[model samples]
Target chain A: MSLRLQARKLACERDDRWLFRGLDLDIRAGEIVRVEGPNGSGKTTLLKILSGQLADYHGELFWNEAPMRRSRKAFLANLLYLGHSPGVKAALTPLENLAWYQALAGEPDDAAARLEALASVGLVGFEEVPAGQLSAGQQRRVALARLTLIPRPLWVLDEPFTAIDRDGVVALEARLSAHARQGGCVLVTTHHALAASSALRRIRLGQGGDDAGA
Target chain B: MPGPDASPVSEQQAGVACREPREGTAVAVRATLKRDLVLMLRRRSEVLNPLVFFALVITLFPIGISPDPALLASIAPGLLWVAALLAALLSLDSLFRSDFEDGSLEQLLLSPQPLPALVLAKVAVHWLLTGLPLALMAPVLGIMLSLPAGSYAVLALSLALGSASLSLIGAIGAALIVGLSRGGVLLSLLVLPLYIPVLIFGAGAVQAAILGAGVAAHLAILGALLAVALMFAPWAIAASLRISING
Candidate 1:
């Protein structure tokens, strides 16, 4: 199974300001690509564009050698994106959140699977507790549990480590590396460094090094 | 790197790939509908607020205008219709606010399923909780307003049909303004204008019934409006939601 994501001459403007221009990237399976930049440097914006969320841009994106627009459904089906927010409902428990999320992703509903996912994320006793009562880190964990439930080829994560503690960060890094080893690709933007022993690539936005040649 | 044995990749893939049934648009709609209902149920106040507002507004009309049955009866149809329209509008601001704030809206946008189907589901739940209840409650309020004897049934039926269009059209405005911090007033401004046609026909149906005129034409127009909304409003709402979230 071979998969590739390529972007050419991408440019984006926000609020009459040029966030980035002439950016290009290529990602392949079994590789981890990290987007590095300072605040207001368009790291999150670029991630959103790659994930097909933000469209106000000038660029061409190809997934597996096909235009992203022409094959959006297939591309999206093969992609999993986790944005800066945890995206868990406060009124729902972790298990319920996972169930709805899986259903949205077109995954089969499995109560036992959801329970096990929550447990794997160290949310054992809190499975039934509403997410509103969970701490910031615990809520983030609830969202992260999705990584275990589905095995999409590409993951675009924005600030996945925002509220995570040291242990959570280490565990998440291991998961990223493992995913890469399993022939999946990951695109992540975070201030914290990932301790993954894999073929890591970096694209530093806003600097001259906007293009990370594969 | 973690050893292959320690990695959950194989187990996770097996779990994900070995499912019996794959979800589709129908599943997406059901999931969104169920989740929204559960959220609204927990915050029962949201479901009840518009109904109470509809009742309160109806109650004030008789006292403010005049308590005489003739005076109240003459104006009851328009009064009830207008009050219900405003009440439904009041609840529109909340349709997307919580979801947007909690970041679940982003998830919905990113879902592989068609956004229009999911949006239709959300609006369906809104109608069920707010619009349908208001329609059911109109008869009780109709008696209080001293509406003509034969018009009570027409009032309830008109509202049931008219509110469906209201929910659909109002959802577009709600989606457009969801990103703004103070969108309550702007939402009304955007939606109320579009509500004119619905109001004219909805009130007309009851008026015709009271006057002993044929109510068929008004009811037909209202149903036609709802059909048009059901066909087009979902797409508009989905597009507006995208703009609000991406902009």
Candidate 2:
């Protein structure tokens, strides 16, 4: 549980409008940071920049005190990002989808638990079914299945509660708390309130303050 | 299937499975290749369409032009090369489309593995399913075109080598426009110009062989083009993917 990520003077302007400017932020392990803002407030853009997916913004990002630009591979190695879209292949079954992601993770040992992870997400017999045929909630569960199977230290989740059910929401909240407690961290953006008990920090955008949450 | 005792995954089992020693690039490449092959094979119709297009277009040339054997023979090299090139382009749109749509492309960009290596795997799968089949299928079309007696093997050889370069070049355009919902026309506009060198050399190989000249120089140049593409296209593809996704 140490200072894991830091951003300095991060500013993003899209279409001649400033989303956030002169923003400084620090994130440590064993913490859950929630990014909240009105729609078009650059919440998703911020998460994408942190995850190294979008590079159109102006900022400095650091992972473990090293500039992310220099250690991008290291940053990506420790990161897992789940966007609004579930990233599930329609042609691949749930098991197959998880299996392909497992390959990208580059760890072959924990693959045996993929079925159990799907089951935990309430996708019991749907393991062999094509993800496209599943409901949107089920498809989100397929992407969420990675939370259990892939053991990354940092997670950047965008609207993770969308299309998910009540039981799923509770289970995901519990997972997030457990992860924070285990020296891992998460930076999540959602309209739905998270019930994770402690270590929850809220950072509201459009206010021009990086530590607006604390 | 999970046994009855499978519980919600224990986050505290930190000692269990986080030893992520970077597996070699070859391992990532194999996994990507196998994943794409399985996906392309399951969508069998998409895989078959390009070869079918090649045959149908070759069949139309005789009806559209002339049925005279001598006339067809004189133009067969260009005819076969153009048709095969179009078939390869027809299938190129899918090279990164589905993955881009599904957000798998984002996952790929974030993989700790080399992006170029993984992209090369995907392009290799494209050639295996589309280009290789088109090359194998060209000789049959060569017969339909009344291609000269000894030039059949040369036609196949040239196409097989030439189409590898085609897949590589076409992939660059596919990557650039993958973000567009309707990139088919834009892709052709971007890729067709780059395809000219391959078209010239590919048709020239068969033409040289048909003319009873040394086909070695033409084939060597095609191989050289493939080598250059193999060296650089993946990096371009990876960069373009980032751009498309970011934009």
Candidate 3:
């Protein structure tokens, strides 16, 4: 299987403020790499860099050995990154939101199936209602609905469990575990420990030493 | 539902699965335009605000400044064009703000389609909402201004080209300032100066028509500005959006 993510000497900065420097990491197929760190530790920045959202960072990030900086669309097409914000438009119905997302992700005709995915995420009766009217957890679930499609090979989740209820968190863990079991990779940053049976590895950032251990 | 032909069934299902990743440019552009148009239509207020602003500004001149038919007729073209520009700028702040706030902008950035194409779709919808309506309403306002019968053609033509350019160029400012909260007023301040050339040519075309110098030169300039913006604004807007979004 191809290497899912490979970062070499990755460095990131914002507003002349150095966030991370000379960091290297890798995740292979069927792997779950959790990035643990305190707030302002640049976890989200690192995820954005790895996911090909920020290109000004130093060093190299490769998805399937292709430089992520050069061809982001191919890289992004193979991965899904859920940031802190759920990213759903409030005025658009859940189905409409998913349908637009599918099209933007280049999956226009998949609205019917996308609606099914939305339903699986507990957005059943509210499928046609604008996402803004839904509760916070429901909106997050609307974003999570994209995971059920499974077209992408890698999932980079930043604080996915934020605002999720206890049951929802368990369901998410199971989904992540199943994704890894199916030879997919997941790079996630979360405050809570994810309990799963998969071969999980943790990378704790922002420590005094180079403390990279599984 | 299982049967001896389950293998074929599974193969067909694989071929026709939902949630599959999309992978083309033209298809993506079409889909994006459709989505944007639908959103613009549903949010009727956003579409009408600029038009109303145009009419209000046009009406304000006759009430606050002067109702003298001679003066209104002479200044109508300039007032109408200027008002339309301001009105368009008024609505441009929402071009990306709502999307950026709701995370839809990030999804658009993640799309496999080129960012410029997505930006074009957005600009197109903006033109439909803000620019197109103002263009249609120019003649009505022209009559109010007592615009010479001969200059009405030039007035309408200049507005069409001029507002299209305004939408395109305003999109650049909108994308740049979207990262900042309360970007609406600041966006106008930033984009208004940039619209000087369009406003110049747009109003000049009408003035020339009344002066019997032929409106061709001004119309051509307005068209040229529109072309220049069409060529460059998308790339600029897309790049700016990426910077603000990732920052």
Which candidate wins on DockQ?
Answer: 1
On residues B9-117, what C-alpha lDDT tens digit does candidate 1 reach at each position?
5665543221222448787788888988988998899999999999999988877878999888888888899999999999999999998988899989988899999
Tell me the tens digit of each residue's lDDT in model 3 across A1-214.
Answer: 3545788877777677667677778788778889888888778888887877777788887766767766566566677778889888787888877776677666546767876687667777898887779999999998998876535667899899988888788778877776676566789999988885556888777733344434
Here, model 1's chain A TM-score works out at 0.95
The parts of candidate 1 lying over 4 Å away from their true place are: A207-214, B1-4, B12-23
What does TM-score give for chain A of every model?
Answer: 0.95, 0.94, 0.91
Q: lDDT winner between 1 and 3, please give it.
A: 1
Clash pairs (backbone) in predicted model 3? A87-B103, A106-B22
Q: What TM-score would candidate 2 get against the native?
A: 0.95
After best superposition, candidate 3 residue A45: deviation in angstroms? 1.4
State the DockQ, from 0 to 1, for candidate 2.
Answer: 0.44
lDDT of 1 by residue, A75-173 (tens): 777788888888999998898888889889898778997987787678889999999999999999999888877667788998998888887787788
What DockQ values do the models have? 0.47, 0.44, 0.33
> For all candidates, what are the clash counts?
0, 1, 2
Stronger candidate by DockQ (1 vs 3): 1
Q: Please list the residue runs of candidate 3 whose C-alpha ends up more than 4 Å from where it truly belongs after superposition.
A: A13-18, A207-213, B1-22
Proportion of native contacts kept per candidate = 0.37, 0.39, 0.37
